[model samples]
Target: MTAEILQKVASEGLPPTRMNARRLFGSFSFSHQPPYSRLPNELLSEIFLYATCRGVDDRHEIISTPIAVSQVSTRWRNVAISTGALWGTIIITFPISRGQISRALTWLKRSRSYPLSIFLDFRDPSWDWDLPESAHPFRWQDMEALIRLLIVHAHRWKQFELLTDTWAPIFTILHYSRRIKCAPILESISLSRCNAFFAARNATFAPAEMKVPIALFGGLLLDCLREVSLTGVHVDWTTSPLRNLTTLEFKYLATDVTPTKDQFADILEACPNLHSLTIIGRGPQADSPPSSSGSTATNRPDSRSKKSARHVELMSLTSFTFGFNDMDYALEILSMFSFPSIKTLALENLSNVDPPALQSLDATPLLKRLSFLDVSSDATTTPFPLSHIISLKLYSISASQATFSQFFDKLRNLEYLGLYNASKDVLEALKPSSNVDFNSSILPCATLKDLECRDMDPETLLKMVKLREAVSHLGHVSFEFSNLCPTLRTNFLDAGIDVVVQTTAQ
Candidate 1:
């Protein structure tokens, strides 16, 4: 009977309504041969929800989740269909086709009035955007049809993500979205064009660049938005200053479209509740912002110094990741904000700053009260005095001896230290600052209880761990997703140090 029910429902979909659920339940209630079959609909519905609730980013999982369970029996099908949130996350990965579009329509309809989380992934690294129209795998009209269908239900969108290589589809979706009065409940959005930087350089076909306006989806949706992640795409920061954002990231933005100095300050001022902020590829434009509303071309770094600095105090910001073109750009941005509660600070790329620039960072408040320090630098000069940091993660392909010596001198209170891609010279540079003598008995990393490295010399690592274990009782030493020799693995374990080596790298 179960097999027969699945065979029938494979091609048929049950309507999500209480009346439809009762009709299916009434039919199944007549049989009581199986004791488990008498389970109440409410209990069965909870089970159905638990089975289907997961990250629905992959579109193929639609068949594996609610759709697959709905075919188990008539009773199961009714329960699965009636759960509205089960169908809320709609993922579209494959190119548009009539059958796939029809399937998506069915999912949307079954979702009913539930808020939606949509993912549209059109990223193909191998396919050249310059390919002729005849060589394209998908028709433009079919893609537009899918976009239009999603736009029709714009008011229901709670989280929307689009990862593509070009801006054609993005413009199409936003053009039609002009009709939506406002997305009052929409909390987050992400638009990423992976090949945007390279695509913009082609003079043969420069896709006309357009700023993401606030009028999109009707009114000021930024009032409720909390998260936004963008790469190689930008909004009109000149006018659309975001507020109440908890997380914001901008990656790989071209020089022409980077945010202006004033615009960047506005974002910092407006979003006092920001938790995580990341900026890569030159950060915000250093020069003055454009005076005119039409021109955003002045969004570039100036050779001279900034005119002024505006100080801001954020009580909630804990994590900040900055990678810019120069040391000055990083310091310029850091000097403007005073984070009394920052816990994590990641500084990348500009670690090779000169003596003056490195010394200038000592005065900035960003280097104080840091709990975790993630720094990539090759400068011989010591950057800052961060004796309060309990953890530090260092990433450098060819770090200097002076760099390691200076870093260890300041981070005396580290309980956890992480190293990535540890080479021979880098590991050798991790020597004790003071030569061993009978008079002095200080050990390296005296307070360190945990150590982590992606790859390292096993003999050297065992020696370091053993030395620390003698003093602070080093509890755990982790080598994530890396191989460990059996001899040293046993030695580490024998020393009562927890050694973790994952076979598959994540």
Candidate 2:
């Protein structure tokens, strides 16, 4: 047979191969196969749903992989497009373009009845330019129109994430969404990088500009909000309706204006049944803004303040995470919230220490999972109390032998321990010279099961392996090295230690 005939005969069961075969038009001819035809329709539909729905993570990777898969043939395009599950997701990019928005909406419409998960990330500077000439989708004016379409099938919206550093469009969108009196199905809503709010009477960017009144939302959003994260946003009684929320993440940058204590009180008053909260604050931003002279500095709770915050007690909170540059703010939160049931505590950006608060935190017995990012242990001879922690993660420790030993000693029950930048002093103290032989008796971590050490020296790796052998509870130990530490990767493996090394770049 001829090569073409032979090639065609070998591919008889395959879908039309327009991807690599002859093309009749500029675009590949799509084979008219219903998305469900190639496989069980229901199963294929579920697969499409799995592929399209992503929580708060960026879908840039998922988007690229599927596009590549769909390019295999014309039949796949038909399957891809007809399977509304495949195209139901909404991924937002800033400088929202007219052409892009049009294409995205078209994709959503094809999902038949599947609720949409919209990820509108407005980080691009030129996003405003892409507004439709008459009814710009990127403009706040088009918010109602957008929400109207979404609410028509709101039950299908599994996730809604709107993340941006700008504030102008967020409130505008929220104001329009008030008509959604009952969307008992919205699963995730994230509004991050909030930099706008009318203060006692000054604009952040232009103090003289006339301010717009931001309408408060009470009890309207809680009917179905399961996971929510807010950053740099002010909250008051107006947003109290989100009482049903379970997972909440609050973050503010040091460059942000500190809300009056009453503003903070208003938020606490709303969510009574909150289960998990992650608070991230940049102290530098809080100090940058000028506070009104009349504002009270006394954090002592007044009756009115207590009334607002006390009404919505967080009795169900089980996980608490605090990332702060200032220790005072961290202390304030710990003193206020009596998280008797909290099991996880993650502390990040520990620049300074409030000795009193650290002492109070150590007394807690409920903490189980603890993680410290860039933790500073300069306060005293002992490390912070972590007797209750079962899993510990520490990153960016100073090269102090005292600090390293203190930290390791506290994690007696730890099953997972991750250490980054194994400092020079730590490695040297463990082994001053390569010629010195180490044994299992000198190791720490009596109950360690998984151990990961990043960016450490060969001497340190050897010590870690010996330490692992000494700890009977340790089942696996991993030594990860950056590309610059390839020699150490080889040295540890050659020394009979099982190590998994990953390059810093890849």
Candidate 3:
């Protein structure tokens, strides 16, 4: 009967039907099912999880699935949404439009039962200036609503981030009033250009009074924090309890109290598991003076207290990058770190008074790569000599042949050299025929494979050739220049160096 029914249905123009009356409502057998239908659900979940986690930049970017995932198929979407872990984050862009806020709220509601994470990125690309006053139709109300929603599930929240130019004072009062509940599971935070506390109090006329009860502003929350990036914010370590943090970076940290290394020691002591740290300004404000010798000590507002209670020791750090605006204090802080496992180090905006600070770093003997940026400081002027650097990248400065020779002579194992400047005299010294015998004292980059020289002049062709020969293992070399006059291009080709010219018109 089933076969006759199937034949009649097929004849009526419907697709051929399988005659399986015995199967009834039961799932089809393995041989009758499509390929991959028999695969275990666990394996499928793992595949989706890996893809979802790949491009995750932070908690915010991961609040939802990447849009491309939906294009796969209906089956994939079912699999993706079924994996509740994939939909656990709520990321929102600031100036939150009604639509965006509504979408984020819906996602948060769906994720409340599971662990939740919220990312608030106030950075808007459309604004010419970063000030909040410039934002059009700013979404403070939307943010307030979102914050209120998260407070209900604060214990289940995994991460919270607030990167904003400013916030309404009412929000601060709400936070202090014990109305702003934070999640116990929250793990990481990043704050940029915000005075979330007292600064908010004076922002407007009907400002909300500060009432948030704090055993600590950031104390209990520090237990699970894995990383923190702060710029222009004061970190109160004494009251804030911290234990297991791995990475901490601070830039332009403005504070009322003078910062000292001791305070830093205290802060580090609080977080015993810290692995990486980048502190941009080393000393107190310029208006403050040194009480001691001819020079003042490096000021760190948090590190000012002399008495050391307990110190946190970081045994897992593998990298450290320091940027200093003040030369004197930068020298002091660089000398303090004992990163036994450090492999990469970068120093930026170093002045003539600052190279002497390099002498303080004696910790990382296993360091593999080092970079110096925007250093116009002269060799004679620098109080310290950097002899340990093997791979070096220099920007915006040219050293005299003698100065460079002296510097490289100390790097016996130096291999990679990248020069960004192409002055005629500097290039001429690199030429083998030039009277400057760089061969004798200069370190031969035996393993050097890549060389890049930018902004060359028409007269520096011989120098390019010499540089190639200087590095015997040269495998790849590229030269980039702009404002290439015809004479310069001809000279570059004549010197046997491959040239790529970029003109303003293009």
Candidate 1 ranges beyond 4 A from true positions: 1-36, 54-63, 96-99, 128-143, 196-219, 288-306, 348-418, 422-450, 455-462, 481-506
Q: What are the TM-scores, per candidate, against the unseen true structure? A: 0.71, 0.62, 0.62
Alpha-carbon RMSD, each predicted model: 12.6, 12.4, 10.1
State the RMSD for candidate 1. 12.6
Instruction: Give lDDT per model, in order.
Output: 0.59, 0.50, 0.49
After TM-score superposition, the amount by which residue 213's alpha carbon in candidate 1 deviates from its true location, in angstroms, is 7.2
Model 1 over residues 18-43: C-alpha lDDT tens digits? 77877877553576568757888888
Best by TM-score: 1
Range of the 10 consecutive residues with the lowest summed lDDT in candidate 1? 360-369
| lDDT minimum window of 10 residues, candidate 3 | 361-370
**Where in model 2 is the C-alpha error above 4 Å?**
1-40, 50-58, 61-84, 125-156, 194-219, 253-275, 282-318, 350-388, 395-410, 420-444, 453-462, 471-483, 494-506
Better of 1 and 2 by TM-score: 1
Candidate 2 minimal-lDDT segment of 10 residues: 360-369
Error of 1 at 239 (Å): 3.2
**Each model's number of backbone clashes?**
0, 10, 19
**Global Cα lDDT for candidate 2:** 0.50
By lDDT, is 2 or 3 better?
2
